[model samples]
Target: MIGRDAELAFLRRVAAEARAGRGGAAVVRREAGIGKSALLEQTARDASGMRVLRVTGLEAEAELPFAALHLLLRPARHLVDGLPWAQQAALRVAFGQGRDEAEDRFLVGLALLTLLSDLAEERPLLCLIDDAQWLDRASAEALGFAARRLGADRIAMILAARDGGNGAEPHLHGVPEVRLAGLARPDCEGLLATVAADLAPEARDRVIEEAEGNPLALIEFAGMLTPKQRAGHLVPLPLHPPQLPVVSRVERSLRDAIRLLPERTQRLLLIAAAEGTGNLDLVLRAAKESGAGLPDLEPAERGHMLRVADGRLRFRHPLVKTAAYREAPLVQRVAVHQAVARALDAEEDADRRAWHLSAAAVGPDEHTGDALAAAGDRARQRGSHASSATAYERAAQLTVSPHRRAARLAAAAEAALGAGQLRRARTAAHRGQRLTDDPPVLARLATVAAMADSELGRAAPAAHTLIDAATGVTASAPGDAAAMLATAADDAWFAGDAWFAGDHAALRRAANLLESLTPRADASLAPVIGTVRLVDGEPAVGLALMRAAVPADDRGAGTIVGTYAVFSALMTGDDDAACALAAARVDRCRERGLIGELPHALQLLTQALGCCSHAERAGSVGIPAHCGPAGRWAMTGVSVGVVRRSTRR
Candidate 1:
């Protein structure tokens, strides 16, 4: 397939080697619709005369009997069926039911393995099992036993499966595994032409992408598309059209498999699909929210999605979710989602909780709405405005009342303000104000609008907006009073109150009033606190305030320390202290790949310590022994400004 040529080649080589009795067997893996079967089929066709044995798996047949290994051993039945009936019956019972006659079954199974072993007396015997994800436990154990005993023998085996399934074959100790994926563009194009010849070259290319390099899906999806969607650009479509879903031949296999799931499992899958990927735990938790006991979901057999080595969980397939969700009645789907939203809301896992609540209610649930709002507030405090906006949007989805929806929208705008996404902020603010008639909220909007300007460094405009918010709104309102004071404090700090020679006394009064009026302490106030003290000629005070707001062991504390260290090095004469602080902050920054703070710290520290200064300080201490870019920049900055180390001049 597309990016799996290397894996296929390696598998074939291993199988051929085992067939030639030159080496041990091999193993391969891949995800759903990744051509695992196709590779095995190709291998089978290529080894037509090599005593090949094939076994296929089925969703319905998995629990019935020894269907899987029996399929693989079917070709050898010429020898198996001829065995003594009593022995055969004993073997059959053993094959299907593990506990019936352990010794007898084991002996019969051993006899069958002996038969296959003898069938390949001189020539190599190759066995291939497809849909190994659903391989029966009995069949799997038999294969494992056979595999274990076939070392250095003229036998090879290949088991193809959807890589991460509950029924996936157990790992083989010596046998290597190869995973399959989608087909190459040309292979896909060829397949497309064979299936649907009317597609123009451009349409053909687009079909290529719609399939996600999945050959089976590409062929199936092309059959259902209307002329309009399939007639254009060769680029990938972000969202599939409602009507033109996967209609390829291979897609039918997956569809049939999903049809067997119970209604509750189907509902569970659909809700999960709406939340997107890597959400198994969330989905399972939310699926239980229906208040319908596990008995109700008995038809929908649930299985834990194991974590892949790459650190992500996957549903058996996206198609399974699509079928399950699309098949769910709309009213039922919405009701279940609402329940899941409530459950997630009750829990404190903000990020995923926001997602579940958003999809579940889609209207209003007080608990879900409140939880989303809290999550949004938390995101803003952490300076992740993007996440804040997302949280606020989820809150909006849970807001049935227009007024509440408007408030949620406004909160999103507030988050956008800190992120400097002015256009987005303005859109949210406008929509919110239009929907709500609350005067206090209008006044708050004015204040937030003003803060937006201040953040962009337009201080004069910022002051005018602040005054408008403080006076234009009701003065007696406590929240407004506190907000206005906070705005005043921000303006005074930005205007450099400590350095303003003309109005030192007046500036201090405004700052003091704002500080006194500050209400409902939250992490959101941490940045503002640090900003004020840093500008008021109190770096130590600013650092202390930030530390108080962010716990010592928290991720945010490192960021606050970093900001203060940089500011101190830049505006004061504390090179050595700055160097040490910056070095620690840089390592933290690099570990998390934090932007904004790391570069600033580096630039500041670099200016305070030049190369000669470093050399002198390093007399024997030598570069802090654990330096980061901040230390290096400090060295460069000092060297350039003092010793003419660069050609900038």
Candidate 2:
């Protein structure tokens, strides 16, 4: 608060606007100990007459899907029943309270927005998220989704995250940001004076310089000084090696403080750090198993290192928890993880228990691997694709059989692709391919890798990979081979479009490949085949096929087939058909809350409108503001630009 007046003022304005039903959000980003958390705390205190919800991300739970979001919304669980049934079911699945079934990730996010808006009906709500960089990918995405769509609602979200390190969070990229910098000279000197007023002039100046405007460092360095050092009778050693980063120096200081604590107190802190959820009962059970008890936590409390409140234990700073876990010996860390795993309720906390067991394993353990694989299945059921990828990756690492490992890696790659982690999907797929020679598994891996590559703009290579994969499986799994060929056609189209505006070489090659396969009576493949034919100079036949594939109902219009049909119509200059199909797709997306598909649908519709010469209608298209960066890009990018160009032509 000392040097953060301007930042605080901005947050105040956000809060004021939200209170007046013009909601907004801001992400506070900075290096460790730059007062991001403190700023949020100060803002919470200043927001009088508002309901406040706070959730801090824990490193130990970073791979657990929706963990932070579950914690943040625990107080509002009663409001879930008020949401639409689809939204209710999505929330229930995400929070692990309902039958295991896949739910759209964006639907879960919309459910969160609705629940929070309901809560804010009584009073303005301030949601503070600290250490957001450590939030699980699913939780971060869900939170970002809700934050971007709080329009006309009495809610203000402020997320604080560490930047410029391995912990950087890219999920919150599009939110308004307030970056904190090192304090100015006068502010640094003032802060140092408050913590080390009696220090000798030279030592005080040295402390200020060494602290480098970090408030935590200023207070901690001063606290570490001896009487002699303070009085100038003896020089204090440098706070840390000059080469160490500021965060490392602070963590080292915190570790030293932990070492000075009683052995039992250190063990208690370790248990708390390992548990991560701060569930005091779970911590106590784990501590009891580890030869520590509730009494041992008193020392840490008195030292202002952590606090126990409302049956939960919380560290004073995220770095304290990090230091407690990292400074411990590997054996001790493993033992704590095992103890925590044992303390978990076998039926209720199986996912967390499986993760802890995996963490505790020192070598290949098939049982642990199986447990993690099951955890991955549960994550996938909840549509937490990033968490599913992490669980499967860990499972693959612990499995002894190469085939099983390959299968797990394949699953990981698939989940990563669903999570939009293109590079991770490609890497996992490549690893899976290297492990297995089975044609089916190889084909699966190749398909995933090619899809990832196509999205990453390697369309030509992607098409080639898909073609080879389809050929390898053509005899045994004709259905899968045909599906791969269909995808290959799409990629080939992209390749041709990207390289030469009107070139048909890639499309011709793909068309020939598809024609060689025995065609099945699958309606889904019609548009894909039609697209190939259109680019292969058979416009009349292509347009007829594409027109036949167009859905007669709105429900089917929100599908991949519908997307391709729209594209084909556009290509063949059937403006009326293209606009109608595209409009239906957008309408279905909005009605069903299919936020993930809305951006693409909007883009296609905008292009269709342009082709139909409805420039005014295209300009006035109702693109959702909550559709994140993708929707914004669709509105401003080539989707709209190409439409304008076509109209001009």
Candidate 3:
């Protein structure tokens, strides 16, 4: 509020643009206590006259599917009846009101999109979600899906989260993001003066230096001192100054402030933190069981720890709720989790109940582990891979059997990979590797490692992983082994790694492995065979095989064979077909959100466009002539000499 004029102006303009029928989306991320909530509040104010909807994520409700979306759209529920019957039914199924036997997640996302578009038809819609990191996976993905597809719907979305917060949505990665930083020194000093006008020069210098220009730390530390201490008239106590970063100082302030409240009032805050949804009924139920009542909430209200609005309670800041839960005793935390778990109906909110049961567990419990695994399964079915990874990882921790724990950990790795969390996938894969050496387990781990490495641009390691996997499983799983070999050959050839293509040894090895597979009819085997044969000097046979492997319908298959097929077309002097294929591949990759495949598609499209002299359209793939794919792929003997531009960044 003090020094955010620039940010406020930008957000106001975005809102104005949305009101004028231009859809927009922005993600604001920063460290905790850096005033993300304050920025969000100002966004709501700037969106005046617009139909502003709000949803705040809660750590306790982080596992509840569609919980955040339901909260955000509850006020606009009447509009759902006007949507197409299919969309309305999809929403009902998503919210557990209808049959969920074969529910499609994309349909749920489409339903929410239509519902928002309908609302926008009446009035511009401004959706502000604070603490997006804690949004349930289904809700985060659905909201992100809608945000991406809005064209001219007069809708704007603003999301705020701490950097790397749990349950973060990847779909928002491409959205315009602003990282809020600490205030500058001059601005910090000016703000500090507003809160501590009587501070002496020496004391003020010490406080500012310790705060490191963090606005929240400056304000909290200034308030904790008396006027006399501020003016250097009284000696300060020997308490330690807050450590670096704004979040720690805020946490200390919140914890210290809560200690001033009565025992029952503090307990009430804890219960609310535990439930997270701000559902008054659920909180009251939990509070009653904990021997507290409605009167207990008054003290918190007076203390400004919470506010009641439309029969729900909201914490003053996102930090207060976090601090309350974090600072509670272990036994008390477990008891509250158990109480909330007991309150949620297992049939309706099984995922939440499972998560709460896991939270309440003090040690290994197979039943809780099984419940968590089931929750992970449900999350997977809903396309919430990241959430499924978390649930599976937790389930692994709770399982007593070594093999089952290893299997769960491996599953977590696979889910994390599917969610595009490469670091987590690597960690989970490594842990699983240490726990088991079974060939099948090793093969799965190797495949995960190879795919992650390939996405990260470490082609050699990826090829090595593929080769190892192929070697380990060739005897028992011939089809998988052949596929892995083909993948390795393509990666090596495209990456132009010296070991694979400098002398063609790697490609030969991969080809040899494929040949040993008894010449099966698997479509995947074609690209590698063709590429290896072509590179090794059998051009006619290679072109024939590659052409046959190219999928007629899937323009953006982005597979190893697909890349070679495009190259084959270009080599045959079919520049027009090649460009069209490349463009289609790019479009398909974007449509499916295949981020890992996008780079390849873009590179291929750039080459094709350059060869066709479509210079004006080169910007579409975000590449210049100097860095076209032709030169980049030339190291492996697949050069397009027609486009003789340097492929440099």
Candidate 4:
């Protein structure tokens, strides 16, 4: 709280921006015990009246994917019911509350953003995180992902992390950090004097020297001294005593303070620490089982180590929990985890139970892995792709069989891709590929890689990926290979990437591959055949075949076939047909909630509309021999092909 005026001011600015609907986030970085948490708490106070949500990371649960985030968002669970079904399912899957299914992880982030935006419509929202260094990978990525997209939402986030610590994950790189340094000399001296007013001059000087500028260290060290020591009864401090980090010394002081409390009281505090989140009933039950009663918690509550508020036991600072658990014996810590897991033993809460058991497991266990996999499956079915990926990844790690592990890893990779986690998808894919060379597994990896490449606008690589995959699978899965070739041909022709756009060899390869496949009576076939014919000097024949492919009614053709029809019409110089097809595709995309696909449909519609307008403008003079870009490209290409064939004859 002392010497943090500038930091507080920055937080206030963030809060003000969020309140005014221009959301922002600030990452407060400093070493442990440097008052980062204190500044965050002050920011929460400064932003009074806003809906505040607090989540603190615990080292114990840092490996549990989404643990910190689940705590951060649990209060907003009611908002899930109002999200789109996919998003709703995604959130549930992430939280382990629904059936597991592959879900777009961004969908969950979008859902959380939308939920907060919806809540902020009534009042601003403030989110505070302490010890962000220990936040799980998935939660950290998701939060950073969501934080970057909060421009128009009424949300402010303040994250506190130890600078240069193990928690400094790359996801935190872009977020602005407010590096907190030691308090000023005056502020440090003033705080010490205020807390230990009766201290003699020499003892005060000694405390200040050892305490340096760390506010927590100064206060905790001040409280550690006896009246006699404060009165200069202790020996004068050496000029250069063995130095320890202020945060470490502060933790040692906390450990000494914990030793002064009664055994049962200390045990109660340890139980609270092990549980992490202060679900009052669960903690109370765990304490009771540990032979402690409500009376035992009274001392810690009175001493300000914790407080009971609104059915939750809130820690004064997250460090208190860390210290409490850290000071406990290794066996004692294990016992407490088991006790907490036992207390949370509800069949309906299998995912959480599995997690607790996973934590308590001394070593890898296949049964536990099976439980997690089952939980993941449940989550996936509910459309929680993020959670499903996490569970599957962990399950794969725990599996004993090489083949099963590889298969699970592949599933995790696919789910990560579905969640739009490209880096994670690539990692999982590479790991799976390292384990096996099964055709199906390779196909899945290739599909995910190709999709990621296409989404990232690397059209050439994506087109090659599809073609190579098709070639690899041709003998074993001819139908699938044909489908892949069809996609490759489309990309090679119109993706607009230099690698594919002018790669005549790739186009010919795609066309030849499609030609070799046993043709099926599928709607997509017309576009494939027409595309081949158009580029093969049979423009009229290609246009006729494309026209025949169009369904009798808009309802029958569907968007995919309809979209191809629009392009074919434009190529054949039928402006009216192109306009009608493009308009219908746009309408269908909108009706189906295919928002991501709507832009493409709109782009085609715009081209079609422009062509129609130009055709009308030329009506009085008769349609121009050359019309739009597509028309010109088609006419020129076909004419050149015709001339070449005639010269050969």
Between prediction 3 and prediction 4, which has the larger lDDT?
Answer: 3
lDDT of 3: 0.75
Q: Residue 299 of candidate 4: its Cα lDDT?
A: 83
Question: How high is the lDDT of residue 624 in model 3?
Answer: 50
**lDDT of each model, Cα atoms only?**
0.55, 0.81, 0.75, 0.71
| All candidates: TM-score | 0.40, 0.87, 0.73, 0.73
User: Taking the tens digit of each residue's C-alpha lDDT, what string does model 4 give over 1-649?
Assistant: 6688888998999999998889988899877778887788788878876999898877656645567878888777777687656555656766666645433334455556666777777789998988888886667766776677677789998888886654336667788889887877788888877888888888777777777788777777777787778788866743234387777777777877888899999998898888877888988888777789788988898777889989988877666787898899978877887788789778765776666666666766788788878867765565445666888888888888777777888788877776667878878877877787777667766767776676677656777888887787777887667666666666666567454244445667776776677564355557666766777667887778777765433555534455667777777777777777766665554333333445566566656666675555333222243466555334322322222122222
- Per-residue lDDT value at 337 in model 1: 60
Give the per-residue lDDT of model 2 (tens digit) for 1-649: 6888899999999999999999989999988889998999999999998999999887778878888899999889889887766677778888788895754667787778888988999789999999898888888988887787776799999999888532227668789999988888789878877777898877777777777888887887777887888876566554788588777988998999999999999998988898888899999998886578989999999988999999989898888899999989999999999999999976978988998998899999999999999999989988899999999999999999999899999999999998888999999999999899889889989999999999998888888898888778877887787677767766776675544443366566655666666465245567777887876779888878777765543353325456677777777677777877777776565555556776687777766776665444444455443444444445643332232122222
Task: Please report, as a residue range, the 10-residue window in candidate 3 with the lowest summed lDDT.
Answer: 640-649
Residue 237, model 2, lDDT: 59
The C-alpha stretches of model 2 lying farther than 4 A from their native spots are: 165-168, 184-203, 497-521, 537-560, 566-581, 606-649
Ranking of all predicted structures according to lDDT, beginning with the best and ending with the worst: 2, 3, 4, 1
lDDT of each residue in 531-606, candidate 1, tens digit only: 4565567779766665454332223433433454344443444456545555455444333323334455455445
Model 3 CA lDDT for position 540: 95
Clashing pairs in 2: none
